[model samples]
Target: MKLRIAILGTRGIPNHYGGFEHISEYVSTGLVRRGHEVSVYNSHNHPYKDDNWNGVSIIHCYDPEYFLGPAGQFVYDLNCIRDARKRNFDVIIVMGYTSSSVWGSMYPKNSAIITNMDGLEWKRSKYSKPVQNFLKYAERLAVKYSQYYVSDSMVIKQYLARKYAVNSRYIPYGADTITPAEREQITPHEARKEDYFLLMARMEPENNIETILEGYNQSNSEKPFQVLGSTDNRFGKYIAHKFKNDSRIEFKGSIYDTAKVRALQNNSYLYFHGHSVGGTNPSLLEAMASEALIAAHNNPFNQAVLSKDAYYFSSPAEVKELVETVQRRDTEKLMVSNNVQKIKNLFSWESVVDGYEQYAMECYLDFNNGKIIS
Candidate 1:
C-alpha cells in the first residue's frame, strides 16, 4: 500500500557521514521507486542542499551543531519533531534515539513511530559516565514512546527483547557487491592489490584503532598496514603519535570516495574490523560485500554477522598471530567466495529496503486499526 513516510535522524543524505545517512539514502530512494511518498529531514547545513534527492522530498531543518557542539543535536532533533508533527506522516522512522528520545513525547500521534535502536550508545568508551547514563535513559524513552522498534543486528534484537521486553523487527544495513572489473579501476596509490593489510574505521576508542596498530606493529609481516579514516579526534591523534615511528603503518585519512573504499576493501590482504560496540556495522558488511577476508573483533555483534566466515581476534597477540601465521592463497580464495555469496543472498540493498517497507506498513496498519500503537 502507498504511504507517506518521513525519515528523521542523521545529518542528511547523499551520505557524507556514517551508517544512518547511508541507510537513509537507499531506503528513501527505494520507497520512492515503489510509489510511496518519502521525505527525509536534512540539516540546514548539509552538503547536499537540493530540495529533492532521487524523487524523495528533503526537508531542511535548522541545525546548530556546528556552533553549539553536542547540545545542538537536541535543538536539531526538536526542530525535526516540531516540524514533523505538522506533516501528518503515516510512518515516521527515527534512525536513532540518541538525541530525539528526549523529545519523544512531542512526536506526532498520527504517525506510527518506528525507532531503530542502534547499538547500545551507553556502552561506548568515548562518552563520559554522565553522558552514558543519559543515553541509557534516552533508550528507555525511545522504548516507551515509539510504536515499534527496529534492530539492525540479532544481538541488538535479543537485547531489546530481554531487557525491555520489547519486540523489534530486525533490519540490517546493506552494501554493494564489488566486481573484479570495478575493483581493478580504483586502487589506492599507497598499496598494491592484495599486498597490504587494511583497517578502515572512524578513529574512536571503541573501534580499537590503537589495539589493531599495536598488533600489526608487533608482527614481523613486511606488508604495510593501510589505515583509512580521519584521525582528527583526540583518540586518533594519540593513536597516530603512538605508532608514528613505525614505518609499517600507513595512515591514509578519511577516504570518502566510494570507489576508493571499495577498491581498498577488494584488494586488501586482510581487513581488520576492531569495532567492539556496534550492531551489524556497515563497514564490516561492506567489506564482506567486497569479498575482503576479515579479521574482526571477537564479540557477539561481529560473530552474529560473520559467523564462521571470518577470522576473529580479541587481543593484539591474537591479531599478531593472524598476521604472522595465516597463509594459503587457496584458502583465502575460498573464504572470499563464501563472503561474496553471503552478501549477495542476504545483505543486498534491495532486500534491506523490502524489510523496511514491510515493517513500516505493518506498524502503519496497526495504528490505523487502533491496536498495539502507543
Candidate 2:
C-alpha cells in the first residue's frame, strides 16, 4: 500500500546540517524506494535545487533562517505541521518535538502520529527555567498526543514508560553518513597524523565541550586535541577562547565536511564525548562507526548506548586518567570498535529505516484494516 507521509522538524529533506535533517533525508529516501509516497517538509533556508528528489516530494520549511533560532523556527515548524495536516497525510513523523509538538497536539482525528523523540530537550542544562518549562510543555504535548513515539535508547524508553505512562517503541540510532569505505579513505594527516584526540559537537554548554577541553588540558599535555564543532551559543565562544590559548587544543569550528571528521576519527587514538545531555547523539554513533576507543561522560544514556563497554569520565582527574589508560589499552580499543560495529550494524540506517518503515506501514495497514488506533 502507498503511504502519504510528511516529516516535520529541523529543516527538511536534502539536509544541510543537524542530525534530524539527515534522518529525514535517509528515512524518506528509504520510504520512497520502498514504493511509498513520501514528502519531506524542509526549512526554507535549506538549500536544494529541485523540490522533488527521486520520487520524494520535498516541501520547503517556509522561512527558516528568518526565525531567530528556536523561537523563530518553532513558528516555522508549526506552520509546516499545519500544512502537513492540510495535505491529509497518513502519518506525520515528528522530529524535534521541542519545536513542533504543540501544533501536532492540536491536529484532530486519529492521524497516525509517530514522533522521533530525539532526547529529553527540556532537561538540558543551559536553558533558563522558563525556557525549559516551555520546552517541557511542548515535549509532553507531543508525547501525550502522538499515537506512537520512537525512543532512540532504552534509557529514554524507560523514562517514557515510567514517567509519561506511554509505551514507546525503541529504535536506536544508525549511521547514514559514514561508511567503512569512507573510513578507509581518511588520510592520516587529516585524522591528526600528529598526536591528538577527536571531539565534535554543537558547542553547547550541556554537551560539556568545556569540561572535556579542560579535562584534556589537565591531562598529559603532550597530546594535541582536534574539536570538529561549530559554536552558535555563548558557551561555545567562551570555551573556544579558553582553549585557544593552548596551541595543543586545535578548535576547527563547524566542519561541514563529515568526511574530514570521519577521516580524523579513523586515524585518532580516541574520541572524547562529553555530552551531559540529550539521548542517542548522532555524532556519537558516527564516531562509534569509525570504531575508535571512546571516552564518554558517565551518563546513563551514554553508558546504555555504549553498553558496559565505553570508558567514562566525570571530571578532569577522571578524564586525565582514563584518557591515559584508554590510549594505551589494546583490549579497550578492540572492545569499543567491536561493540560499535555490532550495535551500529543493527542500528545502521538501512536496518533502522526498514524497522521504521515497517512499523509505520504496519500502523497504516492496521488503520486501514480497523485493527489498531482508536
Candidate 3:
C-alpha cells in the first residue's frame, strides 16, 4: 500500500544532532523511495530550510528549545503533534517519547501511532529524581496512547513486552558500510593510522565519557585519545576542565563531516563506545561499518549487538586494561571483519528501512481491520 506517513520527534534531518535525527533522515527518504508519501517534522531553526528533501516532505515547526532549554522540547513536540493531526497521515511514527508522550492525547486518533521507545531515559544520571519520575510517566503515556510500538533493541523489546504486556517490533538502527579512506584523510586531525584511540558521543552522563577518559588517563599508552562531540554543554565543560592537563587526550569537538569522522573510525587503533543507554546506537553501528576494532560498554544492549565479536568494558579499570593491552591480533582482525559482515547482513540502512516499511504496513492493516485497538 502507498501509505502516507509522518515522522515526529527529532531536531531535524541532515543529522546535525543525534541518533533519532539520523534515523529520521534515512527512514523518511527510504520510505519515499518505496512509493510512500513521507513527511518529517523539523525544527524551524534547523539548518535545512527547504520544504522538500529527497522527495520527502519537510514540515518545519517552531522550536524554542534554544531559549527554553529542555522545556522547549515539550513545546516543539506539541507543535509537531498538533500539525500531524491536520495531515490525516496513515501512520505517524514518533521517534522517541521523552518529550512528546505527555501530549499523547492530542495525537490523531484516526492515525496509527507507532512509537519507537528509546532507551531508558529515566535511568540517566543527568536528570534529577523528579525529572526521572516524569520520564517514567511519559513512557507509560506513550504505551497507553500509541497503537503500535517499535523497539530498536531486542532487549528493549523484551522489556516492553514484559512490563506493559505489549509486543513491540524489534528494529535495530542501521549504518552504511564505509569504504576505507586514504590514511592521509586523518592527517589534518594530527592522527596517524592505527596509532590513536577514538570515541564519538555526546558528553552526557549516561554515555560514561568520564569513565572512558579516566581509564585512558590512567593508562601509560602514548597514543592520543580523540574525543568527538560538542563540549559546549555543562557536562562537556566539566569534562574538559577535569582532563585539561592530559596532553594525550584531545577534545576534537563535533565533526559533522561524515568522510572525516568515518576516516578517523576506519583508521583508529581502537574505538571506544561508552553509551550505557539507548538501543543499537548509530555510532556503534557506524564504527563497526568502518571496520574499527570495538571496545563497547558492558551492558545487555551492547552485548546483544556485539555478542562475542567485540571486547566489553564497564569501568575505568576495564577500559584502562583494554587500552593498554589490546593489540592487533589475528583474532581481533577476525572480529573486525565479523563486525563489518554484521553491518552488511543485519544493520544496513536498506534492511532497517525495509523493516520499518513492513512493520508500518502491518500496523496500518491491523489498525484498519480492528486487530489493534488503541
Candidate 4:
C-alpha cells in the first residue's frame, strides 16, 4: 500500500546529529524506494536545505533551539506538528517524545500517530529531578496521543507494556555490514590497525564516558584509547580536564566522517560501549556490524542485542578487567564473528526499513477500518 507518511522530532537528515536523524535519513529514503510518499521534517538550520532528498520530501521548519535552549525544542516540535496537520499524511511517526509530546494534541486528528518511545529519558543522569519528572509526563502524553508505538529494544517494548498497558512494536535501529577499511583510512588519526581501543558516544553522564575512561586509565594496556564525540559540553570539558595527564587517552572530538569512523571501529582492538540508558543504540549496532569485539555496558537493552556475542561490563573495575584481559583468543574471535552475524540477520538497515513499513501499513489499515483512533 502506498501511504503518505510524515516523520517528525529529529534535527534533520544527512545525519549531522544523533540516532533519530540517522533513522530519519534511512527510513524516509527507504520508504520512498518502496513506492510510498514520505516527508521528513528538518530544522531550518539543517545543513541540507533542499526541498527534497533522494526522492523523499524535506519539510524545513524554523528551529530556535540555539538561542532558546531546551525550550526551543518545543517551538521546533510545535512548528513541525502544525505543518504536519496541513499535510494530510496517512501516518505521522514521532521519533522521540522528549520535546514533541507536549504538543501532541495539535497532531492531526485524522492521521494515525505512531510514537517511537525512545529510551527511558527520565533515567538519564544529566537531567535534574524536575526535568526527569517532566520527561515522565511527556512520555505519558506521547502514549495518550499516539495510536501506535515503536520500541527499538525488546526490553523497552516490555517496559511500555508493563508500565502503560500498551503493546509496542519492536523495531530496532540498523546498520550495514561494514567492509573493513584500509589501514590508511585511520592513519590520519594517528591510529594503527588493531593497536587502539575505541569508543564513540556523546559526552553525557548516562553514556558512562567518565567510567569508561577511568577504566581505560586504570588498565596497563599500551594501546591509545580514542574517544569520539563533541567535548564542548560541560561534562565533556570536565572529563577532558580529569584525564588531561593521561597521554594514552586521546579525545578525537566529534568525527562525522562515516568511513573513517567505521574504519576506527573495524580496526580497534576492542570497542567500548558505555551507554546505559538507550535502547538499541545506533553506535552499538555499527560496532557489531564493523566486526568490533564489544565491551558493552551491562544492561537489559545491550544484553538483548548482543546476547552471548560480546563482553559486558558494569563498573570501572569490570571495564578494567576486560581491557587488560581481552586478547585475540579463539573465543574472542568467535565473539566478533557472532556479533557480525547478528547484524546481518537482525539489525541490517533493510530489515529495519521493512519492519517500519510493515508496521505502518498495519496501523494504516487499522485506522481506516476504525480499529485505531488518535
How many residue pairs clash in all the candidates, one count each? 1, 4, 0, 0
Clash-forming residue pairs, model 4 = none
State the lDDT of candidate 2 residue by residue for 1-374, as single tens digits: 77887777767667687788877888888889998888887777766857898788988767644647657877787778767766778877888687777776565355677888878888887889998999888888887777778888888888988988877878776784456667766565665552578888887777777778887887775777888777656887888778777888887787777776776776777778888777788788887777666788989888877876678888878877865655546677667657667655666888888878877887777666667432
My TM-score estimates for the predictions, one after another, are 0.97, 0.91, 0.95, 0.96
Question: Which residue runs does candidate 2 get wrong by more than 4 Å?
Answer: 64-69, 108-110, 176-181, 184-188, 192-194, 368-374
Clashes of 1: 1
> Candidate 4, which segments miss by more than 4 Å at Cα?
180-184, 188-191, 372-374
Worst 10 residues of 1 by lDDT: 182-191
Give the distance in Å from residue 249's predicted Cα in candidate 3 to where it truly belongs: 1.4
Please list all clashing residue pairs in model 2, or write none if there are none: 12-42, 42-61, 191-264, 229-254
For model 1, the local distance difference test gives 0.90
Ranking by lDDT: 3, 4, 1, 2
**On a 0 to 100 scale, what is the lDDT of residue 320 in model 2?**
74
Error of 4 at 257 (Å): 0.8
Most lDDT-accurate candidate:
3
Tens-digit per-residue lDDT, 105-153, candidate 4: 8989999999999999999989999999999999999999998999999
Q: Each model's C-alpha lDDT?
A: 0.90, 0.76, 0.92, 0.91
lDDT of 1 at 24: 93
Order of the predicted models by TM-score, top scorer first: 1, 4, 3, 2
Residue 217 of model 2, lDDT score = 81
